[model samples]
Target: MSDRYAPDVQEERRAAIVAGLVTAAVGFTSSFAVVLAGLDAVGASASQAASGLLILCVTQGLGTILLALRYRVPVTLAWSTPGAALLATTGMVDGGWPAAVGAFLVVGLLVVATAAIKQLADLVRAIPTSIAQAMLAGVLVPLCLAPVTATAERPLLLAPVVLTWLLLAALAPRWASPAALVVALTLAVLAGDDRSGAVWPGLAWTMPTFSIGAVVGLAVPLYLVTMAAQNVPGAAVLTSFGYRPPWRAAMLVTGVGTIGGAPAGGHAINLAAISAALSASPEAGPDPSKRWVAAVTTGTTYVVIAPLAALLTAVVVAAPPGLVAAAAGLALLTTLAGSLRAALTAADRAEPAIVTFLVAASGISVWGIGAAFWALVAGVIAHLVLRRTVRAR
Candidate 1:
């Protein structure tokens, strides 16, 4: 009986390792371009962006490892992809890259506060789901359109990337964005300019400088998006797998990770939502008790790959103007669709949602604040006014 059981145990260990590697691969490859693009848009130099990516990977990986080991559960963490998309749309704020770093620090503090203060978490929860989703949908619209716009701009170069994405999406949906990115990266290399001096893992740090505009425009929206889109969904995913993650501990870990990585150029880090399933699900192993192994493997994989951030950043920097955007756009398509569906799901709240969506997509800024902050402002007001009118009626 012991000998017979040994084979099963070995198989489970193998499956756990495979699942972990796949989880890390899918998570990193799919949205890394979006992160790089976001950092660049917010004025991160190449080295700074690479440093940001590297630190994000290291911190989230370390956080996941610590959490999974401590709780004996499969827990995973990731950079806030939607928050990255928000940065891509927000562009450069009043104080530029240092200011953006400052905003990142503020977001980290806010996450810590949410964990510590019930009222703060409640306040985040109180933001109407429809409005939040709408704002996210609106922010995603422009970034998601990159592929379409790139097609017209450089038809020959972008055509293959889009085709690969569409084909893989239909057949192996999980690999779609990653495959598309691979194609784009290859094209970038073939069409490469002199990248002779590019560093293997170029790293840089920027001292954070805070301003009111960055705090309101970048930090506030980033915190909201990270919480609403990543942290909440991640908890739900883990719960669905019968794992009761230590919520406060996870928050504190991620918040501290975010704060530590901020000056190094990382935007934000949080619980992994989509990728969490890769490690926590039955796919990791038949026995739920053993799934934590997969999480450890996943975390280890991320740390191992973190060093490649500079190489990837160099490739993107050397690529054509629209190429990286096209890949990033492909990566975000599903997220955009989901956000849109959620935003408009309820008939009663459709009006406010729409208002939020339009304002965010409008790309407007007032008094140095970006559209995302104002979209929330517009949405809450619309929701309240409409509610009062209905009561009066």
Candidate 2:
């Protein structure tokens, strides 16, 4: 009876349900830009690409729900939107969907290995919270400027939505950051940009083709970027809320989810931050000790929704591209800034961080993998070499 009637317990249950759905929806919305890029990279027919994203999303959403449920740790899992962007420009450039899927699998394996090794999470944990916070801010900075960057050739497309995003974001962060996107999409619909209001992806699937290009360009870089950019921050989010999730369990879940999503075109799976923010609040569970159930509930919901993913993707595609870009870019500002700071600060490692930041910011491509992976590698190597002599001293 106490368990049933406890206000905090009840509140937490309520928050879990609400936040789970909101996270799934917002995460799907947030991921569209990279999905678009991935679709184009494979040179898929519009309908095929659209369907692929739907499948990818469903896999990601279902995987998130599963991991969340298994650990009951509020472990919000999401595919790497940034990973998709990398695939779009690099991996899929020379390859097709088959190769793209191959990349996904390889990367998923890497994530699993990281978990098995248990060293990756530990390394990230070693960083000071102040440094983590700074890194997050730095990563998110460019995302803030993305809207402005797209305006030159696409003002007609990006202007109104970007303006609306800026107004709402500066005025009311909580309401604006997530809901502004829904509102922007609605306005786009009223203006008739939603060409496929009712059309949805019919049952469709693609078999993967293994290729060095996809593996190096799409898979390897995607894995690295998602790990550094998304997973690290996700852990920080949990820690910030005073929960230290079991790294082995969480990484295994992330790895499993990534593998599951690979066949369907997913990029990577990592823990959540902003979305998980909902379940971690005091309202979700006053005890905080028993908050695992909330994540369980969330993961279960993702699985339930998986079958209908194509339908959901159809809905996501209805929004105008410009509006989608603006909303996603806005939503990610904080995150991008955070990554940037991590890459930049560190007086001893400033040079490497700068190199990493510049390369990532440059948006260049090498062998079909995006710059984020290279940036991280570059930074890591620089940091190691520079610190080696100091440590020896």
Candidate 3:
């Protein structure tokens, strides 16, 4: 009798399941857009890009699982959706995929090395949570805005999808999210976004290359952007959820994944921000105590989904852009809203957050890294100097 039944344990397990499923649904939309756009940056043929995205999703899902299991904490893993956005507009301006892959390896190594020393984590922690939250908001604000921009073109195809998402998001919170994804994709495909069912990309493997240009232009910026805009917030998210995972573990996994997938147009791997939050939220795990289980569940789902790299790639190619855009925007609203709320809360830090938000939104560039890094650097300096002057007074 003592060994047979455990109701409390079962309730905890049920909560974990809820967390994993919701996050996975949200991740599909957010992650896919970045993957699709990044492929365009790398000059990947449609098939190759799709496969790369699939590989990325699967890997991150797996990473979320393995880490959560090892730590018995809600240590979630996700692709750098913003990092992919950083790569999308300008990556093609570089040496195409080859140079981009070279840049990817360098950044991956940097993340790994960051884990090797405690200094980086200390530095990250030194920044106020308010500032970190601001950076995160800056990164994700685009997700909410992109859909509006998309509607400027394909309203007919996307309006229905968007409306459907809204209806579901409001009425049936549990099944609505994932169900919206499926319906939106179906509608998009019906609208002829599916470019025929010839769903196979020519697979290729690329070894890492060296690029002094990429080092300063791409790698360093990626490191800064990803660390500030993604990983730092990611760590904070975990902490907010009552778990303390080793930062090294997160960095090491990203570094490894980055290097391994660069040849395939896998640009960056970092702690997921929005999707991870959704997955690890109270919605995902009703019982806060079972959050780890939710993370583990996310990982298990990833493992199941990762291996059919080719098939997964094909599906992305077949999906319509309008559909992807609308769904992604709708799916990620809560994420964007939360990040914005956090950014504006710290009165003293408001100026810096505004600067960061502006720079990132401007999509300007310093070298090759895009606006995300500069926004962080700019905000941090502004925040520090302002604080210093105040203290001096």
Candidate 4:
């Protein structure tokens, strides 16, 4: 039989398509609430948040398709989940939503600069992994507590969502968040929560305005977290799967995508870390070289579902208070646990990491700069001081 016609090859192709669809479905459903909350937290109106979500889906989807086909690698991309979480926690910054939009543009430029300027790349890389992870862990702490807090405030409304999440977490861990979201939306409908008028999709473009505080507080931290948490690990995952990722190209693509979507309220987009595994792993196909099909499928799936963003946003907007947060919170628990473990695992760096975590979790803002930036600053200082003391000893 010809190689193309082989039974095994056909099976692999089928597997790849299925894996891609699953990747898109899981990636979109799992953390989208976090994205909405982040945009809303930054002062985006309902239309703006929906626009942001739409642009995010469209840009990353197209970027993923382009990269995967060009490189013949399963190069998946995602909106920066950690960055969104940072926005949710950081709240409204110095110049409100316009400034936040400006910060998103800056982050995109920085990403492109990272690809083009070796010195800038080295500087970003020089930040200690422990400190970076600690900052992320710290930033995630409060958001991860949403389920507990929501339960306390609205037990009756959230109980079904929480129970659905718990049951699926045990039986089908990957579906837990998505399932919980469905339950929440269902409850919202049953309660007659209505926002049908806002379901039409359109760009809610905002003029970008720069400010010193937003650049430092929002852009800098967002860039670091997206790099440390998503882009870096995404490359590592592809490498582990035997494909040499085109790093420069990947950064340029995601960076440009980020910029293009910024005015529409999308925060940032980058290479996918967690969802990359769905299309890059052997589960996509036993033949390593053939997995790009899965990535193409993933991207296509994202594009197809991009129009639903407005509808989803309307449902979430009308959901019972704390319900969406509970779902988003549950989605992030695994990420939080992983970040905490990575942050504290090194005995030598424990103190600095702890310092970083505490500062971030404290949710402090000084001179209009948020805790994420300060956490990194404090962690680095602690690390330097401790190292010098040891050297003196």
Which lDDT values do the candidates have, in the order given?
Answer: 0.93, 0.61, 0.67, 0.92
**What count of clashes does model 2 give?**
31
Give stretches of model 2 more than 4 Å off: 2-12, 42-45, 88-91, 118-146, 149-159, 192-199, 300-321, 366-370, 384-393
Question: Against the correct fold, how does model 1 do in TM-score?
Answer: 0.98
Residue 162, candidate 3: how far off, in angstroms? 1.6
Instruction: Show model 4 residue runs off by greater than 4 Å.
Output: 1-4, 195-199
TM-score of each: 0.98, 0.79, 0.80, 0.97
Per-residue CA lDDT of model 2 for 32-91, tens digit only, reads 555654555555545565555655555556665565556556667666665555554453
Worst 10 residues of 4 by lDDT: 191-200
Model 4, 1-393: lDDT tens per residue?
887668888999999999999999999999999999999998898889999999999999999999999999999999999999999999998999999999999999999999999998899998888889889988888888989999999899999999999999999998998899888888877774674455679888999999988999999999999999999999999999989999999999999999999999999999999889999999999999999999999999998998888888998888878888888999998888888888888656589989999999999999999999999999999999998999999
Candidate 4 clashing pairs, residues 3+ apart or interchain: none
Alpha-carbon deviation at 379 in model 4, angstroms: 0.8
Ranking by lDDT: 1, 4, 3, 2
Q: Which is superior by TM-score, 1 or 4?
A: 1
